[model samples]
Target: MGIKIIKRQGQTFKDKLFIPAIMGGMKTTLGHFTKNLKDVSNLTTIQYPEEQPTDVATNPRYRGVHRLTKWEDESEKCVACYMCATACPAECIFIDAEERFDGKAEKRPKEFKIDLLECVYCGYCVEACPCDAIRMDTGILSFTGSSREEFVVDKKYLMNNERAKDLSND
Candidate 1:
């Protein structure tokens, strides 16, 4: 049996004129514009700062602010392996490793810092961590700072931030 091919007819004079397509596009545009203009609530865009989306902190998979996890003893889980720092493509992560005096581990981060301004939120740091020390599940979507220094978060801030503590309940 031979396959039958049906060819589409050429464009009519109306289609060739392009008036119908233009009118259709304009109709769609005007419909949305008028609908949104009449009732602003009809729009799906969330008014940030004043009106936060209800789904902000509800999703576990949502990546937001970065945080450092702690052990049951309240010690930092980061062994200062520098995996996160190395994996960070933005070079936002900075870590100063120091030998542990208590002899519990070979090294620990004396100073760990992340520049939120430079971070691209790629979640590479979290994936690179073998100890589950780093996480981006703080559910913090808004970060405002008056100065550059305010955006640079240190180890102390990451470990003690309220957003970081919220993950424990999950």
Candidate 2:
């Protein structure tokens, strides 16, 4: 079989000079500038921490903060399976499982921590969970901390997050 070769057209004077492309770009820029000048609201500047953008839309499927789900007894649903920690691509999840002494559950997480700096928010940990113990639907887009140690979220904080309570209202 013979290969079919396609012919290409040569550039015109306007294309060679790039005058039309430059004019089109300038027109678009001038239009946006004039529109923004006419209506200040069209500008994308936001005074963060004091004033948030009202027109901004958040994604429903956005994975933000992580929270541990609770059982009916108000105890953590996580059985210390370490599936979340194992599936974490960033290795941000850490779990230390220990046998329960009170006979309430077979095993419990002695220490569960997640480094926010290292977490990629990929939601793989939520998918890898067998008991649906973890969820990333807190709707918290910001996680501010003064120090590196403050970014590390332990099991206690995960279980009693204020954002978790806010999620129930929605």
Candidate 3:
């Protein structure tokens, strides 16, 4: 039975001083600064509030904001199964189920609320929906509100993709 104790190399004065590391970082910063100075017009910076991107919604990979989709008959596509809420990692989604008053025995969410501040935008809610009811394709990013209460969106807001007036760019 033997215990192996690995010998470690002690830091020299130069290594402890960290001059090389600092110089490397400064070199990178100065390199970028000189490059920008040479051709400032070629910068790809977007003037966000004034110049909004045109392809946020059209881009397949862009997941902006949540929206509740609808069936062909203009009815909500949700079946009130609670699968989305169950799958949500953030636990931001809340659903209150209510039986349909119509002859059909279908159920619907009386209160479907998603706290935008709490949501991680992981797209798990959309994938977990069996009825294809929810999606994050509105391209309606940059929302603003006076308080946190205004951030918790309801079913009606999600369905119509509303809250445009709350947009920060507005």
Candidate 4:
């Protein structure tokens, strides 16, 4: 005649309400389907080739292309400084220094090349340049080539033509 307090274990609240939950999910799914079908023209995806989305580089500080600057005299402002080469993590930059005809032996890179295929574009070279002769601000986004050799950019190609004027101005 004593009431036994047995713990209720079988068929919890979730199991008891399964039918209602399933009906609710089905209703929401059907609602979404009807809404999508009603306004198919309102879809946000753009047709890539026909309508290219403008590349919006939101960050001004983003590192993209590398530019070699010169002093106002238009001479190579590089002074053959090896800081960039030493700082490069990938060891992509190679520089060959030479003594100028002038009695003062200013370091001048006879051959400077950067293997774009190996470069990480980390802007480490730009930061390491003591003369402010290098910068990653060319605004050039992409470089394309069929082979590895084509991707290797030489100093003549990377050096800014206007850099000499900039050097002279300095």
Scored by TM-score, the top model is 3
Model 3 Cα lDDT, one tens digit per residue, 1-170: 69999876547888788888899999999999999999989887779877876656556766778988766666677879999999999999999988876533389888999999999999999899987789877778577899999999999889898423423331
Model 2 agreement with the true structure over 37-131: per-residue lDDT tens digits: 89997566767857743332145566888999887778888899889999999999999998876666699898999999999999999999998
| Model 3 spans with C-alpha error above 4 angstroms | 1-10, 55-58, 101-105, 162-170
Which 10 consecutive residues of model 1 have the lowest summed lDDT? 161-170
RMSD of 1: 4.0
Q: Estimate each model's TM-score.
A: 0.75, 0.78, 0.83, 0.62
Error of 1 at 78 (Å): 0.4
Candidates arranged by TM-score, highest first: 3, 2, 1, 4
In terms of lDDT, model 1 sits at 0.85
Preferred candidate (TM-score higher): 1 or 2: 2
For candidate 3, what is the lDDT? 0.83
Model 2, residue pairs in steric clash: none
Per-residue lDDT, model 3, residue 14, is 83
Q: Which segments of model 1 are wrong by more than 4 Å?
A: 1-23, 35-47, 102-104, 163-170
Question: What is the Å distance of residue 35 in model 2 from its true position?
Answer: 1.7
